[model samples]
Target chain A: MKKEHVKIANREALIGVGLVIFNFVWWFAFAYGLGSKDPQEYTYVFGLPAWFFYSCVVGFIIMAVLVTIVVKKFFVAIPFDEEVEE
Target chain B: MNWESLIPLILFIIIIFCVGIWSGGYLKKSTSFAQDYFLGGRSLGGFVLAMTMTATYGSASSFIGGPGTAYNQGLGWVLLAMSQVATGYFVLMILGKKFAVVTRRYNALTMVDFLKQRYQSKWVVILSAVSIIIFLFSAMAAQWIGGARLIESLIGIEYTTALFIFAVSVLIYVTVGGFRAVALTDAIQGSVMFVGTLILLIAVIIAGGGIPNIIADLTAENPNLITPFGADGSLTPTYVSSFWILVGVGVVALPQIAIRAMSYKSSQSMHRAIIIGTIVVGVIMLNMHLIGVFARPILPGIEVGDRVMPLIALEVMPNWLAGIVLAAPMAAIMSTVDSLLLLVSSTIVKDVYLNYVKPTASDQRVKRLSITITAILGVIVFIMALNPPDLIIWLNLFAFGGLEAAFIWPIVLGLYWSKGNKYGALGSMVAGVGLYILSDSFFPQPFGLHSVVMPIVVSFFVYIAASLATQKKTV
Candidate 1:
């Protein structure tokens, strides 16, 4: 039998699902929630509506740094013999 | 008088032709004619594999059409297109080591080769061959038209004559040296694309007087230009989200790309590729689209969107520099055209001719047929390109959508889903492709989702249902 799928009931799974939901909410908020106003007119930085933009910048940096670290540590552990043998 | 502008283009072409010559020499070294011509002896390395994948996928659409659309749509298209940053990542992540090992084991030269081994069915092979030939013709024609249009813009040549020149140059080099020629040259073209995007984006931004100035100018022109909903609020949220499937994860299914997943030397290479490819793709996509929107303030009253990038580059950069910078899109167009030429040729030679016509054809005959077919396909695409589409990107994307719908479930499920058999595979492809065409025609953008969404769903069900009902031995 194929390996059983690990239950996606962890924090990472929740966060991933949450972020996707947030993406939809944010989009809907802009499309319908903001009453069709120009989004650039209000790039909130904190409690401000544009604060999300700053979050994206931060989120990108964080994701990049995290992925880099994970790759450096985790992916390197892949056995070299396993690579060529397969 | 303007030799500076022409100098870079001339130099670029010379370097590319020399690389083609070098690859041709390497092609001569291979003992078997078919092995050398089509698959490069199945021995591409880390850097070449990554570069080939990037250049083949980047295409004129990424540099030219993508940015043009971004220019028209504003920030939302940027968000949607950036999802494509994960393209190489997904292909490497999903199909990585296993795909390479299996194909090498099976001696599978083309995507159709994989299906042939898996199903051992001629119908699967024929269906795949038909889909690839038909859709790839549309895709190749789009690239040919883009190449001609770029040349036309630069030298003030008529589109038809420019197209004829472009076709001959690409066909000569690609036919002479097959995949190796294509891969080696892709490394060169990919670098050109990377640097070209940076320079042109910078020039367009500076010409627009910087980001804040551009934003202010956009607001003055129409506040909606700064919004995600497009100039007329037509880019619905659902429309934007569905693109995640079209250009993002769904790209894992594109044959041109999936073939590369199996072409690399090592998993280390795949790991390396994921990082380098993601960064390069991210930079190209973000900068190119931003340049498109950024061009708005500098070049007002631009009626034709596709011409926006070249016109803005010429306007902002000096003649010589603009010539060098403009080569980015030119590289994109040429790289895409060459890869498509080789792919369609292989589909004919390896997939159709060898499998059905002569399972034991001589290696010499195979080489000749492959070369002749590559040239013929190039000529046919040139004819299709003569009357260019209003926006070549749509044609390219339509081809993308259709191919993804046709192959994604079959490839993915075939690999992972043990229950997936030949019957299920055939059912899923037929259902997916049929609905994909039907939806695109009769009910485009159904329920605000992309035309591809429903077909993927329907095919997923078809695969499961057909497999369960058949209950043939699987995996």
Candidate 2:
């Protein structure tokens, strides 16, 4: 039982770390890749340029959705009163 | 001064006071004053937890200073600022249910309490408490200044008078009702921020003659303004990307934020908060920053960037409605200030004083000390705010970077890595804080990245190395 809990803890920790890395990469890629375009090569979308629209507006919505999905699906809901494995 | 606009603001203040008094009733009936005062007795529901966290995290910096910077930096700043969308998710998701369970097991009231119990070291607790006092005091002062500035611009009052009013209002609610009051008020304030930002953004867009006209006006003024490089093209790719660490992932180390991770009632609340908080933060940050950029076309040549939100609201909307909308920034500032005030006081009263100064002090004495410390801290921050900076965002960001560097590895690794001992915690903190301060002062934007990036990276290696070196000594 103890070993099983440890395995579960490790899995959760890995998921947490993985989520952090994925969120970081998502923002970095959107900011650097899409947000670094020159003004001369811009296309406007709903008054915002394509880069700003894609990287910030779309990126923000996508992130909110993605983060919500990850949290609800993978995160195990342990009762706070129970013994927490370190 | 527009007395009409002031009416809405006055009404908002009255509502906040009422909420404080209501929460004070709960405080009075609690069996444990310390826990109830500091942690709301760890009974925060899903929505309340989400709102309080979002409200506390979104401060005058996000509402006032952030939008102001966005106005100056153009759409690129908005893109950069959006990195904060995942702040709530990251904090709750990373810490999760284990933090809640462990903190309850330890009966830890403050983040320093956690550090003391986890590391079993006197120095670690002292350092954590000291860092919270030092960095959070600066952050609190920035919030005070931001609150005062918003009031000053809204009503055309003298800066000193506005500062005094702002300080007194926050001190009364925070000192009287404590964390329950802060959390309760934050729920209201967070809602105000959400609705207020959306209303103001739509008003700005409409006033500027739609989005197309606003973009054309910006492009006409400066073609670069419509691009991703900022108004003057100063927002480089590297600088923008590095902010993901400073404001994004690195936020897990912040005590004010991390403490919330453990305050919820259950894993269900945490999960609920992750979804609600992320959506609220995303909406508020995106709309608030966009309003900053959109304000440019309607109100050109505004000198102080911090005044953009209030100034734009007044220009585009009716006086009373503008006042109502401006409450968003006020709410953001007050929620942040109240939490910081309580956190610092708890550090003094519960962590430092109770632990070292007077371990056997009576509960009444601790309560009085907590209230008195919060009031004194408020006054000190008020005095500090009298001599304000041109932009309070940098001061706020400085505090964020310092706290993140000091506590990130210590708290995160200490929880997960069994081998992480007191020595590793101390070393990580010292290296994180020391290198962060040194780089911020002399080597800002090192290699075109924000100064915070280097310290966080260096501290990670130090933590691993120091832990490995000290493992045998511990056993």
Candidate 3:
């Protein structure tokens, strides 16, 4: 049981680090990869330029979907303890 | 003056006051005033928790200043602002179970309470409180100015009278209802923000002759307006990317937002909030900023970006509807002000005065002190806000950077890493805050990144190095 507890703890930490890295990569790509451009040179999409479309609209949609999936999948719900009688 | 517009705004304020008064009844009957006043007895459900987090985090900057900046910077600023979509998710997810469990075990009332317990160091508590009071004064003042500005623009009143009205309204409700009042009203205000942003965004797009014509006008005027690069080409890759740190994951360190993570009643509520809060924040942020960018074509050449939200709403919609729409920004401002006011008051009364000065004070004394301190802090912030800045977003962001730098590692590492000790937390805060202020003053955007990035990086290293160096032998 004690070893299992440590394994869960290690898994939680691993997941935490994984999410952090994912977030970093997400922003890094948006900011550095697609972001390093002159808007005058880029193609526009739906009144928004490609960079704007991909980064803000697409990025927001992806984040919303990703967050929902991750929460439902990885976050195990721990029931709250019943209120202690004073 | 648009009297029609003012009527809906007046009605909105009246509704807010009613909510405040309604919550005050709860304040009266709560068994422990401290828990009820500060954390709302940790009874916030999923939706309320989601809205309170959204409302508190979405300040005047997100509503007024953000749209204003987007108007100027075009789509790039909108892209930058989207970084905040993950804010509520990050806070609730990263700190969700652990924060709630530990803070409950410790019976912690404030963020400072958690820190003091985690570090087991007096210096950590004092530093945390001082950092909160100092930085949040600017943050609170920024919100006060925002509320005052929106009122001034709406009713055709002078700034001081508007400030007075905004200050008094917030003080009355927050002092009367405390955290429960703020949390409940935040639910109402968050909904306002969501609906209002949608209405105004649709209206702005229609007013701009639809998306196609708006795009044509924008391209004809300045091609960069539709692109990721800002109008001035100043929203550089480095600057925009680094901003994610200031507003995104770093949000977990913000005491106002972080406290919400601990206040929810159940893990199911946390899970629900994680979804709802992210969706609400994403929609509101995207629509509001898009309105700002889209408004540029409809209401061309507005000088003050802060006035973009009000000016565009009035320009696009009818006076009555515009009044209702403008209420969203007002709601945003009031919700932010009330929360910040309560947070600083809790810092002083619960963290400092109660901990150091009178640890044994009776519940009655503590309640009186908390209310009085909240009122006084409101007045002090009012005085500070009289001379309003040109753009309140900068003030708000400055405060955000300072707080995030100081508290991020201490809070995050302290939670995850058992080896983290008082020496590390103290060193982290001192180094983080001191370096942040210095960089912001002198070497802003060091290496082309936001001023906050450097301090956060430096503090992280300092925290780890100091912790390892000072680790005492465990018997």
* Chain B TM-score (each prediction, in order): 0.95, 0.96, 0.97
Candidate 3 residues lying further than 4 Å off, grouped into runs, are A1-41, A80-86, B60-64, B387-397, B473-475
Superposed by TM-score, candidate 1 places the C-alpha of residue B398 at a distance from the truth, in angstroms, of: 3.4
Tens digit of per-residue lDDT, candidate 2, span B1-475: 8999899898999899989988888877778889989999998999999999999889724632599888888887887888787686777767776677668888898899999999999999988888888778878887787788888878999989999888888889898999989998999999999999999999999999999899889988998777667888898878987877877888888888888887888778878988899899989999999999999989998888888898999999998999999999899989998999999999999999999998998778777888888888888888779985544445566688889999999888887788998988899899998999899989899999999999999998898899899888999
Candidate 3 lDDT score at position A4: 44
True contacts kept of 1: 0.03
Q: Rate the local accuracy (lDDT) of all candidates.
A: 0.73, 0.84, 0.83
CAPRI-style grade of the A/B interface in model 1? incorrect
Q: Clash pairs of candidate 3?
A: none
Ten-residue region with minimum lDDT total, candidate 1 chain B: B388-397
Q: Better model by DockQ, 1 or 2?
A: 2
> Cα miss at B234, model 1 (Å)?
1.6
Give the winner by lDDT: 2
Classify candidate 3 by CAPRI docking class.
acceptable
TM-score to true structure, per model: 0.89, 0.95, 0.93
